[model samples]
Target: MPLRAEGLGKTFRSARGAAVRALDGIDLSIAPGEFVSILGPSGCGKSTLLAILAGLDKATQGAAVVGGKPVTAPLVDAGVMFQRDLLLDWHTCEDNILMQFKMRGQPTAPHRDRARELLALVGMESAAQRYPRELSGGMRQRVAICRALVHEPPLLFLDEPFGALDALTRENLNTELAALTAHSGATVVFVTHGIDEAVFLGDRAVVMSARPGRIIADVRIDLPHPRGAHIRELPEFTAYTARLRKLLAHDGRPDHREGVRP
Candidate 1:
């Protein structure tokens, strides 16, 4: 597994020092190069889980490991893309991508070429010199995606990366992202609230319940790879969407399906 969480749990402290459990007893694993999308209702600890796995935050209980190493701090081999682009307004797209190296105390020279290659890979080479302010929301997302992969990490975690884009742009980026994840050869743990997007992009969609979050099910996407927009029209895709919605709606309850559905 590229990523693994055993007996995972997390709790937050309020002003009055009350324990607010965000995640509980979560056990999940992702294989190398596998694209796993996490879907759930609001406050399910979906992003919280991603943050813990990326070592941006610590789990109050259990462990999260990436590439056989326990996640204590941010690991060099894992990359994370949050909801916002978080790109500096001053730098051009290329420099913003290269910033990944600079922030890590790494020499940018070695990673500059890779950054260009990734921008080109995402069809953003032309925007290399353009600042974040010069880019559209969708364009910024493309740049963000390239920046995340510039380091060539083996594992990537994303949290609602496309929630802000328009429908058409979001769909286009979904196509682009699906292709990117496949070609990057990196295991991806994507967190999204969109049921259709989850089924469309994930090899397996992990559905979680509400607060005190726990994995309710792992639904395999039976569709083929290199999937295009038309894939969502397929029976399997729609079926998975419906199933996930059903799961999220009835979450924190019994296993209505009786077992995990492939």
Candidate 2:
């Protein structure tokens, strides 16, 4: 589940037939089982880079390799979660999770236990039979997480999965996600705009620049795993957040002078 991008670049043609660069000279390597958070501004190519890495889109100038193979199409071994829950209103929660296997033309019975386990992990066990319309926003998102993980994919790509939730709900889910995936041995690439969220959950925070995006910094989060909400109050946690904030404030012009405060 290791991922590598070599000299990756992407460009698009505007509606008016103008060329617009979205990414450039991006060289990044993520080790297996590492959780890397991608942090950037709104218009930066974070989502675009993620799409290319996940093989949903092709890089215009370089290559993306996953698990020792060139990514030519969508990866079957990877699981993706987006900002919205995307659950079907008619399907029950457990059935929503089971749909992953159904879509892959795989047997659902064999994966039922795992689906239930994931639901219990996110405190949704009792709601397994509930439809999406009956669940709260956070509960719906928990089901989405279970759906993404029930297949036990070796790689997970999350694009602002908690961005739509309120602050308290987001923080609670952050803690749950850390605990859920702590030992899953999955290489996770999480894209988010929250510095604290990145620091709390990532083994490394990969900061990106503005449009025509490029990596500005790859910061190592030295905090212990199984991080809880209280960990955010620790000085080390604040230091990491501060460093990331400074890097982002530069808007792609990282201050090399600012060393790791932790």
Best-fitting candidate, measured by TM-score? 2
lDDT at residue 205 of model 1 (Cα atoms) = 95
**Model 2 lDDT on a 0 to 1 scale:** 0.91
Q: What would the TM-score be for candidate 1 when compared with the true structure? A: 0.92
The sequence of per-residue lDDT tens digits that candidate 2 reaches over residues 57-138 is: 9999989999888899999878999898899999999999999999999899998888988899888899988999998899
The parts of candidate 1 lying over 4 Å away from their true place are 254-262
Off by over 4 Å in 2: 253-262
- Candidate 2 differs from the real structure by a C-alpha RMSD in angstroms, to one decimal, of 4.0
lDDT of 1 by residue, 1-262 (tens): 4889999999999999999999999999888889999988888898889999988899999999888889999776777888898989989888999988888898998877788888887778888888999888888999999988888788888999999889888888888888877888889999997888898899999999888899989988889989789998898887888888888889867766788677
lDDT of 1 at 208: 91
The lDDT per prediction is: 0.88, 0.91
